[model samples]
Structure formats: C-alpha cells, structure tokens
Target: MSWQTWRTALISAAATALVVGLLTDTGQPTHPTTVAQASPPASGPGTNHAIDDPLTSERTRAWREDRFGMFIHFGVYSHLEGEYTRPDGTVCRDAEWIKRQCRIPQAEYERFAAEFNPAEFDAEAIARTAKEAGQRYIVITSKHHDGYALWPTKVNRWNLRDHSSFDKNRDILAELKAATERHGIKLGFYYSIWDWNDPDAVHPSTFGRYKERMYAQLKELVDNYQPSVFWFDGEWSTDRPSNPWLTQDGEALEAYVRTLDPKIVVNNRVGKRRLVDGDTGTPEQTIPAEPVSGQLWESCMTLNGSWGYAKWDNRWKSPADLTRNLISIAGRGGNYLLNVGPDARGRIPAESVDRLRAMGSWLVRNRQADAVHGAGTPGIVAEPDWGSVSRKGDTLYASVYRWPGAGGSLTLKALSGFDVRSARVLGSTQRVAVSRSGDTVTLTPSGAPTNDIATVIAIGVAPPAPAAIGTGTGLKAEFWANRKPGGTPTVTRTDPLVNYNWKYQGSPDPTILYSGFSGRWTGFVQPRFSERYTLTTLTSNTVRLWVDDKLVVDNWQDHGPLLSSVAVDLQAGKRHKIRLDFRKESNEAVAKLLWSSPNTPEQVIPTTQLYPA
Candidate 1:
C-alpha cells in the first residue's frame, strides 16, 4: 500500500481506540488504579551507580544532557575548496572532485602533497570555542575518501607528513586529541574505509584481497587513535565498473572493533551495508518520524548547507533552530551531532562561532532541566503547536514550542493516572496549579512565559517507569529509474585507452555507467564516489572502481574475478525502457553499476531484472 494510505489507516485506528477508552467507565478507579505506585526518586550516591551502566537508555540520557557538541570536517580536500587545480594552477571545474577527475597522472596529483599545508590551524582554539559554546564533545574527520591521512601512519607514506608541505611532520589528530583532553571534551573520528589512492583497496571485482587490506588499515586506526567513536563511510562501491571488491563483512568488523574497546562507539556503517555497531548515523536535514528500537542511534547534521568549508554555501541555521532540533532529538531519546566546516587556514567561520555562542548562553540557563539522568515519559504525544515533554525522576519537563491558542492550559492524557505535587516553568521557581481527572492532567500557568522560543514545564510526580520502545519494522528501499540509457551497453576496445575520466559537479550526486566488455584490462580509475557503494562489473577484465572515476582495479586487484548476475526492481507486471548516460570518461573503464538497499536479508540483482536493452 502507498504511504499515504497506511498513514490514514493508522490515524483511524488511533481515533477508534480513543473513543473506546472514553466510553468504558466499568467502575475502574479514576486515579492510582494499578496495584503499583510510583517509586520514590533515587537520590545521592546511588544516582551515579544507577546511570553507570552504558546501556542504550543511559547513552541516550548522556547525549540528551550534553545538549551541545561540535562537528568538524577537515582534511586535504580543504586545500582544494571542493575543486582540484592543474599543474600550472588553473582551477578545475570540480575542485574537490577527486583524483581521477583532474585526469592528472598519479605523480602529478601527488604533487599536491607539496602544497598541502594548513598553516593557521589551531586545535586548542577550536576546542576552546566548542567548550565555551557549551559543547561536550567534538567529532572530526581524521580521513576522507581521497586516502590522505591527517595523522602519521606506518602503512603508507602518502599521508599528511611525506606528501604535504605544511609542517608535514605535525600530527593533526594527536594535537586535536590533546586539545580536547585538556578542555574535558570527548573526541571522535570519521574514517573512510574506501581508499581512492590505494590500489590494494577494494574495488568492484576483487573481493578477498581488498577485504584484507581494508581490515588491516582499520585495525591500525583503531589501535592508534582509541577514538571515543568511529564514524565509518564508503561501504558501497558496486556502481563503478572498475571496483571489483564486494564483500559484506560488517559484522566481523564490528566484532573486531568491540574486542579492542567495548566502550568505543561505532556507527551503523560498520555493519552490513551502512549498519554500524552502536547507532544509525542519520544524516543532517533528515529526521526519522519514529525512533528505532533495540538500537542506538544519532542524527549527524551540519549547521549550514555544507559539511566541509564551502565559501559560497552561506546557508546557516539560527541558534533557535539548532536548539529546537536538539530538544526534538532528545525528546525522542536520540542525539544530534551538529557539524561545522573550517576554512583552509583552519579557522572556524565567524558566523558559526556566533551561533554556537548563542546556544551556549541558553544552555546555561536550562542545564538542570537537561541533566544526564532524565528520560522522556511514555504515552505523551507532542504536537508542533505545543512542543516536547521529557521526564526526570518525579518531574516531567514539558517544553513548549509555542504559546497555546486562546486558553493557556496544557493538557496531557497520561497525567490523569498520577498525582502531581507541583508544576513550574523552567528558569523560574514559582509553582503553578495542576489538576488531574480520569485521563487528563491540565496545567494552568499564572502568567505568560517571557521566552519567545521553547519554554519548559516541570511537573513533579511520585516516580517513573522505564521508557517504552517505539514500534517500527526494519528499513526498506524503493527503486526508481536509472540515470543511464540502454544501460550504457558495455563495449570492449582493443586499442589502449590513455585515461578513463568522469567529472562530478558536487558531492553525493549519484553517477552510473553501462558498458559491455570482456577482457583483462589493467589501468587506474582515479575519481572516487564520495559515499561508497557496492561495485559490480560485467566483464572479465580486472575492474576496480576509484573516485574521480579512476581505474584503480585491474586483473591484479580482482580475486577470482567472479562474474555475478545483476538485478533491478521494476513494476510487478509492466515493461519499462532502459537508458544509459555516460557523463564523463575514465582511463580505466569497466562495465558496472552501483546499488544499495535500505533492507536486509534480501539482495536486489540488477542484471536479473534486465529486459531487452
């Protein structure tokens, strides 16, 4: 059924239940009907112990209480400002486009290493700003898809040190670690598993060898950094013909990381597909309507349009918007990792700083209402007009998003079952009157709140029960039309091709190519996809997918060089025409397509679903 139809059915079911509840009196006690009474608030020494266990609930509590944090996306790409430059210094169309797009040889692109200097970067300043802005932790990009290591690594010399001119020896990760430690803030790192520069890395055709290399590097990073959290990206490489590596060993990777440090929080990327160990990393600008149960989750978003420093991307969110988002996430028992992109000189944009400062001020006044032990109450519905409500021991904090219309009374159906000792607006100590009836608790304030945004109402209760998990099934994906026509019939050319290059205008745009070839060709595809995908190649040629659309995979990169069938989802009983569009060319060409699914236990094969092309 369609989403709209499902939603209508759900609404109808809820309305029916509400009517039934109102009609049945059945001599049931109006209040305190259950044999159990609310437990008294746990106090003092035991409070810490009660929260010591780092379960999903405890983590959610800690995150909600944090209220504010910082996100940093910095790497060699910062030097290019999202675009690459030619040898003579002409700015390429897609600067941060990746290595292959520049079409420069490996030696030439490596030449950029000499100029990769972030002279003005100050780790201490960044940490101090975050602390002052009321942030409790900081997450930075330790590495990106380009494969340039921000920290010193023994595995490869193509890191910040040997390749870059900027105090190449300095360790950015170590310095940031020390800075955050001194400032009493937790530190996390974003690591990309897919490497564009590493020929041994996973591409479309080579599965076994690539997995070995990928795991080795991950182990090295985890051992060295001991990061509080590991944000993994680039799990999918199936789209590019050059990428021969395709293996779903996420469970194994997660188990390995946990053995190293059980406390280390790993995102959903480490699991099959993008599923990580701890929680799903829902990108910024998107909020799930319902929460995911039996799993830890967080929403990572940017304060502005871009995650990295983009000079022209000035769209910034106000402090109020940021605070509302935080409260919403917390109310739903989730965390928000707000991000910021620093300039090449390593300076946090002034506008971002100002907005953070504003949030810091508001947090100070409302800290108690958001302390670490509080969890939201169950059976309470939040309306956009009314706002969110959270619960502490015996107190319920109702955060009003806007003033009520006409009457200023706040109503809650779950409150009728409990006795309210007192009610008061947060930031003020004055008590307000609260009345409880069969299934309704009404709070009448003496006066209007002074705050323009959200106002919190604290309701004193006897005690609280554990939170109830929301009901929702697993995730699913719906396939639409392909970007390329006739599936870009794979073609094989005997003549040597100088280079296979493709240009991507922006980050995160899906690009696909169709080719019909059968040969063992060897070349390097440089350009890489920002987000990883499962790579599938149709031909016998050792194919590897690289960002900048380079052919990093060849006969050597492919193990067994297995040819697997492809599948695509179409209307159950309908025919549709296929089209292929080749936007750019690459030196290393292989016929392949990238695909991902939101569902598990079911793999969609594109070739199997193919009709006459």
Candidate 2:
C-alpha cells in the first residue's frame, strides 16, 4: 500500500504492456449521457473496450457525474488498531499492513480472524453517513490484502463466516448494498489482488490455482451483490518478487468481469492503471494540478494518513479543507473519493462523521451541490487566485476560498469577451453589482460571504462565439520528407495546424518519402484573451517549438510520445509568431501543438487564430 512500492508495480506492468502491444486507445467521446448495451467482451489480443463503445462511455460519464464518493477501509486489520507485539519483545504500529509490516507469521495473522468481530457495525448508519456527506457512491473493502473477507465467501474458509467470531450469517456487504440502495447511492467493492495468507498465490506451481480461486470469489461477490464498481488493488509486486500477475492476467480478468456484468466500472489498477488500461485512471492520495486530458480519472485520499483504523492516527482534515479539495477536483474534471477507516467495533471515528456532516451541510446551505455534480473544468475562464472554477453548461460556478473584503469587487479579467447575463451569490438573494471595464468584468456582492469555508458565486452567460477558423488561415509548412532537418525542403505548403500522427503510416504528402521525414511549421497565432497560456506539444522523435520567436519546448533528441509544455503571457488582438520543427527518426511519428489560456480550453491552435508565415 506504499506509493513507492505501487509505482514499482506500475513500471513492471507498463513494460509488459509495451512488449505485448495489447492496448491501443481509439478516441472516446468526452461526455456522453445515453445508456447503451456494451459490445460483447473483446476477444483475443486486445483490451476490453479499446474501441469507442457507447456503453462504456455512458457508464463512465455516469460515474463521473457522481463526483464524490466514500471509501471505507475495514477488515480484520482494524482489530489490531495499528499495533502488534512480537514474541521477540518488539512492537510495531501500523494500519492494514500490520501483518506484513510487523512481520507476523501467517499462522499468527490467521489467529486475529477469531477476534475480528465488528459487533457495532451498522450498515444503515454508514450508508446514511455517505448520503449526509453528499457523496453519491461508496466503495468498501470486500477483501483486503490480508486475505480477510468481510462477507461470507464459499471459495475459502478464511472468511468472516467460517473463521471470524462475528455471527456466521451476518453479511456486512449485503447489508451495505441494501442500505445504499435505500439511500439512493451506488455501492462498489474493493478487492486486493495480492494475498499474504493464501499460500497458493506464492509459489509458481500453485499460482494459477490461486488465480482460479480468486476468480471464483469475484464471481461469488458479483452474483450475490451486483456491485456497480469493482475497484481492484494490490496487483503490484511488492513483497513477492516472483509475482506471477501480468498485464495479460488483468486483461483476461477485466474481460471476464465485463462478461459477468458489462456495466460495472473498473479501475485502471486492474492492469497497470496507465494508458488504455481500465475504465478510469486512479491517482492515489493526490489531486492532479491540471486536468488529466484524454482519460477519466479519480483521486482517492484518506481522511488522515492511514487506510485502516489507527487509534493514534487522529490527523483528520478539517471540513473546510475537504470541501475545498472536492471543489478543486471538480474544477479539474475529476472525482474525489475520500476514505474513512472504521475501528474494531465497526464504528466510524466520530471526527470523520462530524467533518463529513459539516461538508454535507455546507453543500446544501450553499446550494452548489448540483454545480459540483458533473461540473467540468472552466473552459471559458482562467482559474482565479482567490478561488477555483467549475463549469456546467454556460454557467460558471466560482467557489471563492479566500474572500475579498466585504462588498469588494471580484474581478474576472478575461471575461470581457463573454456576454455575461447575470451574477449573484448562491444561497442568497444579495444583489450583486456587475460592472465592466475594457477586458474585465467585476462583481461586487452587496453583503459579506454567506459561509466561512467557500462562498459560491454563480455567473450566467450567453454562449460565447465559436472559435472558428479566420479568413486567412494556415501555417507555412516545409517538409524534408527524407532525413533530418537540412538544406532546402522537399515540399512546402500551407497547413492548418502542426498536428499529425504518422505512427502507422508515413508522409503527409504522397510525393514525399514515406519514412524518416522532417518538417517545420511557421505561423502567427492570435489570442482571444490577454492571459497566461500554457503551450503544449505531444510529439514523437525529435521536436521543438518557439512562440513569439522565443524557444518554448526544446526536445531536440529522438524520443517516443514525449509531452512538453511551457507557460507564456499573451495579449488579445495581437498576433505572435510561432514555429515548430520535428523529425521522424524511425517509427511511431506524431506531432501536435496545443494551447490553453485563462479563457480557453486546451486545443490545437485553430485555423481562425493562425496565418501563413
């Protein structure tokens, strides 16, 4: 469960995928809302839903709309309360991985199952907590890495039913499922792929048998509970150097799960959770600073530092801090899955409940819960220093974490071009005075902020002008068609953008040489707003870029799919010279130039903004 160790597993898995070439991601719709049946699970030699399937898109979109979810890490490890005294007069304190971290023997670890009785576990209360927290979904540990199952499993006797002191017929998972359904929230299960106590999973000879048992257990969970999400973990090779799990295993398991229920959402950890691995990317314990383009993602972080219950780990995040995180993640087009570890008696820490309730109360009081639901990155405005921005349709919701002085002006510098209709403070009828200057609009609330945590400002606007290609639009592109950059170009023409993917083919011009080509694009780019812009390039082989005659990206050596970015100040109504040079060293050629400013979404420089140089 250490991030460093998980990264090692990811690297190994990525290498395997590259060797096998089993994943190729065709583009998917950025947002789709219709529910359609998934294609029959993929057959030989590729990932499930590698192609754009309507069902996958719909399911992914729906999951993304949930926006926030609860993650419960409860298992037999909670009984230890993060401390284990060894026979050799040594004591170790840890959560979840007590057996491994404390170096307890398998027999000794098994004995703890007898004492794993969560007598106070109230499924209704847990589900209610999620609902009260404004969380739309819940993913609890069905089985942890310790190989302790929360529910009764027929596949093994090491489960709560057969081994634990808890009542044999009491099914926590089933109770949770019913409670979640009653509360109108989705339910999911987290299952660890690694098993410390299962001896069959260690040796090479018995690994396949262990895998079969794992599959059977998964099937049992699916048939009994019908979960909406199957979150997998512990696939990385940490303790076991001879770990037999492979990308191929992940692919097969994913396909099998789809066959059982294609509607289920699976995390990327089912494989490496890298490119084209699973339905969604899982970034643990951290929120990405920028929006993760081309992939649906979620960040899972604990309330404190530990995943399982630790009596001494009382480092709970404040409700205000958690609320801001949720807003920040939503602004960056991702979901927040917050964790809560229940103690030995099946009681959620009072601190966690109090904070969660406070957040739910804030959401309702601000009337911005719907604004966070399915809200995406603000494409029309730059994020402000005082707050974060999320967009739903043409409306922008600004969650101001730092309030300006009471009745002070909240300036949106880049919103001059937008035809803003109205502005107001959410959850209040306080008149907001809107005034405009040359390229900026200011909103001054009549009263102080309604809440101390984050004040929501709602700005309604007319749909902005389309960023259409302008009258004279094109870049002067010169192609060598053969060899690296040198001498006169073999072909020259006006191209719209420095965008091409000659990975499987060669040469944009049929007259040019098919392989080992070089090209340069020169143009003038005009910005729509005066703001700081992030210029980005995704390229293969050697590539470099210059903006306003100043070098920006300089990857002048051979490479594969290298993404480089640089930020620069730009002015509206002014044309800046831009140039990009690339050479196809050998295979997998690609080049793209993209930019995003405060008021613009990241996109290839459009034809309207480019002129032949």
**RMSD of each candidate?**
24.2, 10.0
Estimated TM-score for each candidate: 0.61, 0.73
CA lDDT of each prediction against the hidden true structure: 0.50, 0.75
- In model 2, which regions exceed 4 Å deviation? 5-42, 45-48, 51-56, 88-90, 203-205, 240-242, 413-416, 436-439, 465-613
Candidate 2 per-residue lDDT, tens place, 130-158, comes to 99999999999998877778877766566
- Model 2 residue-pair collision total: 3
Tens-digit lDDT track of model 1 for 160-209: 76567778567877888889999988888777665555554534444445
